[model samples]
Target: MAGAALPTAELTTSGRPILLPNEIECSLLSNVELEPEGSPPLSSSIHLRSSFLILTTHRLIFVSDSSAAAANTASYVPLASVTHIFLLKKSIKSMFGSPRLKVQLSVGSDGRVGGMGTRSIVATLVMRGKDDVEAFVDKFRQNWGARVWEREKESESASSGSSLVVESSASSSGFDSRGMRVVGVAGILRREQEMWESTDKSLQDAFQDLNALMSKAKEMVMLAEKMRLKLLSGPSQAGSSNDEELGSKEEMQDWLLSVGIVSPVTKESAGALYHQQLSRQLADFVKIPLERSGGMINLIDMYCLFNRARGTELISPEDLLRACSLWEKFDVPVMLRKFDSGVMIIQNKSHSDEEVFARIKLLITRPDALQMGVSAGDAAMTLGIAPAMAKEHLLTAESRGLLCRDISPDGFRFYINLFPEIRTDDIYLVKDQGIYATWIKCASSPSRLQ
Candidate 1:
């Protein structure tokens, strides 16, 4: 249990594997077992049964099922350490019971797992779950044979040489005179212009097919992160820059952050647990946006923002709703809320409605707001929330006797509640300086002033 022939895998808060850079999930199976068939039980035999199995481009991951009686820690076998994946026996017994797969792993002299060594052990994966065993087997072979892990090394080499390649490509495409005094946003734009001009072929190839687009995914995220870092470092380094330039750099940094999700949970990868995993990812993604939007965001706006960050893996509106709904089952910091009017929004659970109400209370008491009142749009701008949601809050305030509504040529508006100040005994009777009198005075403003 302590030292197995496999490396311990790290999991996210929601118990999903934390993938390697550029790694992609290929398949998953629940309630599987990893058994070692040696003369005796091998010391590396994990003794883990009925666990979850995940196959990715780089590793075969095992997760403890939630219902298991033991501690839930994950373990993985890197395809880099896998020496062989034995052929399935396809016997009649296998067709009746659970299916099993055997893979040879490289181990150190002491029989401990390592990236590579001379000693080896055949790991038998027993599939006891309701998964497509054949599909799992097929993908396992494809991932093992493809050896995509090797591509990461090659990609690193290429990336190290990318600057030289980019310079050559730029020179070939006539990227202005090198002496052009480019700097700041203008400089970034100028560089992008040169890159686009020189990489027109890559742009065209990217959209040629879905496969081509998939290949460009990493580069896109890297570019976004790179720009984000540059923008982040710009202001500190910009001693002579104007306010407008610094502001533009900050805004550009936000956009770059929003545009990149290095790893998005996809339906193809998560399978039946797609919505659950997507919910966890969304919960994490929305925190910064929610903070920037004042602790809440319109569901529709988030849908657009989330999909934009997702790039080609766009989801349906229904999928978004389902993912939001799954947050109830997760311990994420955010929650989905639906107003009485059927508008949906996501807000931090710790966000206080009392603070929002306090803001609205102060807004309603403003001298101008007290005289003419404020519209839903006005409250929205003040509260940094959607107009529809702001209206809901205003209505709640009205119900609580904290505010009052008026509909007139000025459109529907909310004012601090003055109904309790009016004396019903005599309509003519008004307190000297009460809110009722103040309201009457404001209500009688000159038509020309109105």
Candidate 2:
């Protein structure tokens, strides 16, 4: 079957194809089928059925659109392998059937299609959804003709040659052409120099007006990514670097990481699939931050971080909310949760309330906690989470009867619930072995009440 022959594409946890460097998705079409033509009555299993076809600058990716996620798979046909794109034929049979187009592919002697091959085969893309087939075909042809991947390779070769020249001469002179000391890797420094020299005129033009800046946004993002990578590798390359140099590199890394989204999925690019694509992208983006934040983060905080990374293609609150809400439909590792206090957060699916509650239980049982109830800020520090998030957890624990809240001039605080241990019939009665007895000893101490 063609399924065994085609190259498989790896998918993110959210079912989005893992994009290659410089690869950008240009269009999305759902309910499409890819069938290899000119076969000896090919079996049904050979065709990719009812899939979401994504057109990128480098490939045509087909991901199964089945309701059963475990049954889904993905594959791709690289544009480099495609030799010709056939236009739709004007025939009576075509007028009534699903709109389709054909692509000629180069197949190797090893019975697989690829860039350099000895044989040829035809693959038909059958459009079963209500998408503009003509428009998709036009985009397909444009991307194929552009050969962006090939051009990127050529640029890299040229940049590599320039990098070698700079490395040989950089030791002789510690400064760049503009008299700035070399900071990071010598290879990257040389590329930066060449890039700036080439774009100096464009940079001057871009700053004169808003329209110019808008036009040059892509270039600026590219430069930011280069700097970010340089900073990332700086610490590893720093053998005997001073603390000041290290500090500056760290500061720059943080700024660049927060400000650069090399390729953000935009409404202009994904069209009808904007929120779906955004949801997948966000699912992938939040994994690292979620890990650093102990498997959860405030929704508002996420909105800021996501927008900051997106740079010029900032999404609105409504857009972010819509994108997050779509996560329920997709099989993603992260989920959106709302507490009784109306605070929303994005948390990993594996995050457990019981684990958080256990930590809070341990924290509140201490002698100081027994003398004076713990505030949200105190819990925040102990739990290593945001104060607002800690408060939400505290309130949730309170509702569960794990703890009790007290409001006074001192502040709002939470103490371990002693109500369950207290004797209701007699105010003076206390269990000698329980938390109530412990609280009694602590509350009666001289320094605690004063």
Candidate 3:
């Protein structure tokens, strides 16, 4: 294939492809090779031996595990351009090694891979990894034959037509003509009662069957979003509502904030690239929550939040950990970190312990805290991290001579580092304006007040 005008697919920061509108990823296979039977240029760029193959509804995408290599070598073939898919020759040889899928594609007059042309070439998909080749082919064929893009186009046009007709009818039939004329308070109350009953009945009918609920899931998400917007627009009055009611509403709002992933990565859906795809999705999903939590969140908490966002497609703890670990391989903004005590956290790459230490310094040096010191939980609240993580940070800051820990009958606590500021040569000479001086003043002021 020569200048066939093949479009290069753009990838996310985490190396996942930017999916086209309505294009859902159907399957994936790693360690795949694209061998062109007739073209030599294919032997150069499209060869992509031992690459990761991703099958979408609209395109066949290949990516390299290495980010640098992928930038230069990654490419895709449009399903629309595929002329034919050859049946895999299953023999004794195929059972022993990797499986292969051969498909014919239309090329350009100059022999280039493209969407439309006269020339053609046969391309083979060699799955070097142990994968179910037959199932992949079935999915590929199903996606190709479905022509989902065309169906989506037709559905959009139909929806537009239907919406226009309904709007026109509603405009022509005003309140009086629509059988519900606004007369008085009693009439308004009756109309509102009728509307509520209609909505309740619709919800009852919608949830009657699994199939109906699945069909209405999108509508539910839109309705949740509308409610969330309304809540945000309303007046903020913390004392106006009871505590339990407010807590439940806040929890509901959190769920409605991120309704679902639309298409979550699953082992059945992504196959060999499940972890990779899930990693990218998790990276994108955690940005907002991580920012809200001050650039870090407990892994256990993230597990709950992530699964809630995934709805029915819940990932296991192992899957979440693996996905978080894969962030190191990609250029993801978030990274997984484990403390020496085995507590794990998901944090932004740019997040710094120095920043946490600075906040801790400010906290412990407070007028009240300087008298009694700060506990791990106190640091956690100020830093917006787990108590365990905050303790680890405090210990680290202690090691770095930024703080000092004291264990007493009262409790475990941390004080602003004054060991370095204290002069051993002159025990009674306290610095005038240093943290040491502040500590001396705080330590004596409480006695004076007593």
Candidate 4:
């Protein structure tokens, strides 16, 4: 049987290597390679051409651009497999030659490096670029020594234990405290007991001190997570939840879910490649939120979301703008788009105006919408997007002649583009079959026409 092919590493749409959870990029260098230099040649040829080497907390990613295509493929070497990293030797002969960094790794019996069952393999990285080899080596060593993967493993285990605790607690009695007698006045006694616990001298004093602030902060984060969980389960419970209660619950959940970013990439951590790293992290971070926002999110809203996620380490608007601007240089699924009106938004690169236009066309052709032009808010509800974003889409459709705008004291609204289809020469003329005719029939009804 043919040997198992290496597990193909996953990549982001923009060609950036997808990092493991808690994995942080330490350094990035262009024009680097990995090859077995002195090993006896095997039956199969191993090629190591020009590749981008990314050093991260968990692995070293080799991003190789395929000569046949515009896109690149990535391969990774786990840091755990590294037996020893060979320090670069400085010699007069090396002064005029390309710099090289070598690493000794354990390759398993199956020829894969790292993991419990793997043997060992020796690999060398040739730096062909004019970049500082010494700096790259320093970063590589730093990342290896950090042992971030181990820390992440520990954290995962700890969190799993905490989840189990939460599950058990949730299944048990309503309250954690257990010290009350059963009697006729037991219910009243329990209430008084709870009040007395609240009034405990130590507890009362704690609230008056700095500990209260700390406790509140922790409670706030937990509350947010709880609310998010409720929102996630809300639709399933909708049958039992009244509409008004559900609406309020949904609003509260949205607010809570928007409370934070558990972890965020920062300039201090990513260094010179901060923007590039931020761009990639932003791409990953926005997928869910963007989908919920109807594939387009205001730059201001994103800034707030991003900063909130970062928690105490908030980034300035300028930094956020710079990071967004860098998205063009990297292969990211989401891009920073500026409307003609100068309003900026972060939109999925795959998001098409044609799709929105098609939806809008369908919406306006509806009997109700035809009679009453769709306001920004009306479009917002129909499109499931923010009103501001919906207005932008409407304006964009109008610009493309897919729709027409009507400004009235009531508000700015859009109607189906009947301009081209309508016979301007004869105001009353209606084509037998067309959007205009359909719209006319709908509009002609007094009850339908507002």
Candidate 5:
């Protein structure tokens, strides 16, 4: 923890920072450190090492690059709180040492960073990499000058205040701004109709052209996220939802969740570190879908899901593959695996083949399974995975001597590998107690085979 001086940034399971509502990442630096300036260190002497600097439209975030506590080890300086940014000075000493950019931040007496404070502190961002530090500083200055967050705050404040003003005026004057009566059910109905008309007009205008849709994309993403959250809380908050309603809500939630990525890592934003940052973002994005697919998903399926979430900012297949390849260098929980058949998939490092094999063993050892064997489709249903993935597991189990493959006119099926338990010398000899014995008992029952 960096203590109370700097608020910690929230991160997803795969270590990507959670971007604010409309905050967009504008720049990224792979290597940087946050160091306090002056001798009598300003309240707690906050310091971060080997951190990746991410400059968004709203804040300057420093995220630790190391694997341990990567999720928790992040702090940000809101652009709103930054009083001044001093770019790296051109001097002979700068030639031999790392470039440093100084940022003056508003600090309160409580030793916390905020919008306005009685005192201020100067913090130095030590840029270790020689990779385009000038560009990042330029972007920092640009974002600060834009003051977009302030504009958003002003808009939100105005919108919220407008409704109260209307209600207050209507109550006092007994009429709305449009001269409609305020004391009856007809007034309420008229207001509701007006709201729906406005919404319909907005929707119609948004779909008028591609450029119109592009402009409204952010609003749509925000609306989707809001609806998804509402659906998520609906069941828990209401408690009266039936199974069908709950199931439908869950399905709708899944759809809305994939509607968009509010702040996607892009080549323009990440620059030289594009693929690396994209890899981290992709790793974080895949966690949910991977879990749903039983801890593994084909790379093709992942690409589709990822690009869908990214919306218009789609990546080329080559870029996606390159990003996935970089995962081995990072300490992410997920990894890309290529099976013997050359089928590539993304699976968790903690995913155990033995656990999957155990499930397969249980499925195949049943009396019905023992008599007729199990097909890839059968395993797919039992495992809740794709038939292709199920087949891979079945083949791996067969290779490990846990099961045996049986091909017949009906279809490809896997049966328990009882060769190890069988007596080769005696053709009819069966083990009194073992998998072979179980198979014999099941085979002897005509009804079971049928």
Candidate 6:
């Protein structure tokens, strides 16, 4: 059945709304409704029923109940469209019934609540859930008064000009007294001197007190970001940058890029919702990091990286585990995986040992790998993953009949999956057309070039 016309709002794959950059979720309620009260006789004839209301810092989203035998749809009422919110009338009769808070919102002439510069329209909110009415009202007032959206706009504008402003000021300071000199030994010397001075000053300042270090953390993060941008733009500016300089610049950029998390979730910040919210945020945050780590990352390694990015708001290992366990409750794209060896990792849900096995199979089938078998470190480099993670992948593949383990004083290693190829009836037999024959041929060759 067709439902009432409702505005649509986008939701992330994890079911969270795609908030504007810098916008944060404040409060969430499961089930609520909206309806107009005390309208004209003709207008009052229209009835709106139970729905789920989500109160964000910027908008009120009403999602219609699915069982309404109508299209489950969402409508958004921007906070900017709200002019006044009437307090719930307190009385014995009101206290006995469900709490209903009325909100006065300005709607356009076309009878839609919006902020597209149209005339005002009045609307009311009827809360039918077991929630703190006063709390919701207070949040609404706080969000309206804070005007965070406006502040975000100002911040974006400031950041856009910050680089240009800094460059102009630095140019006026006459730091570059020498006219265009070929960037060679002299440039490297000057850069080394600047880095040493900066590092020395930072070390001295950091030792002053814990509080001083905490205070300087944000500036340190900004400095790192600035340095990363400089490295990224340096190659573009220097037409004759050497390969060695470019490689160093890339390394520096990577180090600096890992430096900060502007708004890390903390136990204090998320309160009772810490684990749940952290799980979702961590799931969102780890995608790129996991991809860079080659589809899997050790839980302990992730804990360190996460805590380092969080700076002072360090969470306990227990908290990290709890957050990881909560991934089952969410629809995030990543999962917390535990190997038989009791090692834990965060990996993409789609990441499979079969894929890693395919790569390992291809690697060890080569003449060199066939002869030596692949050590954990060798596999780590070949698979582009951590040595421990690669070992786990290799073990998993071994269990799945795609590889075999080799343990000796030389160290634990994995070889091509010869178990399936080797005839159990004739262990020494090498089929002319199979991987066994190819592997034997590669293994027997004195020089791989043969």
Arrange candidates by TM-score, highest first: which order? 2, 5, 1, 3, 6, 4
Estimate the TM-score for candidate 3: 0.77
Where does candidate 2 have its weakest 10-residue lDDT segment? 38-47
| Candidate 2, 1-450: lDDT as tens digits | 446567888887777788897787888888888878776543233467788898998999888886444466888889999999998866898888998888888877666655477888787888888777778888999999999889999989999998987787666655666676665688466857777777787778779898889768767778778878877887787789899988888888878766555678888677777898898889989998899989989999999989988877899999989999988887788999988878899999999999999999999999899888899999999999999999999999999999999999989999999898777789788777988888888889887757
> For candidate 5, lDDT tens digit of each residue in 270-330?
8887887899899888888998998999999999999998887999999999999998877
lDDT of 6 at 234: 85
After superposition, which runs of candidate 3 have C-alpha atoms over 4 Å from their true positions?
1-5, 36-48, 67-73, 90-98, 104-122, 174-252, 326-331, 377-381, 384-389, 406-411, 423-426, 446-450
Question: 209-253 in candidate 4: lDDT tens per residue?
Answer: 676744455445654576588688878856877889878887787
- Alpha carbon lDDT at 104, candidate 2: 86
The estimated TM-scores of all candidates read: 0.77, 0.85, 0.77, 0.65, 0.78, 0.69
Tell me how many clashing residue pairs each candidate has: 0, 0, 4, 10, 0, 1
Predictions in order: lDDT: 0.79, 0.84, 0.78, 0.72, 0.84, 0.70
lDDT of 6: 0.70
Q: RMSD for each model, in Å, please?
A: 6.5, 4.8, 5.1, 7.6, 5.2, 7.7
Candidate 2 has a TM-score of: 0.85
Flag regions of model 4 displaced more than 4 Å: 1-8, 35-37, 42-47, 65-70, 93-96, 116-122, 130-136, 146-278, 310-337, 365-372, 416-450
lDDT of 5: 0.84
> On residues 267-308, what C-alpha lDDT tens digit does candidate 6 reach at each position?
544445467657766776787789888888999989998887
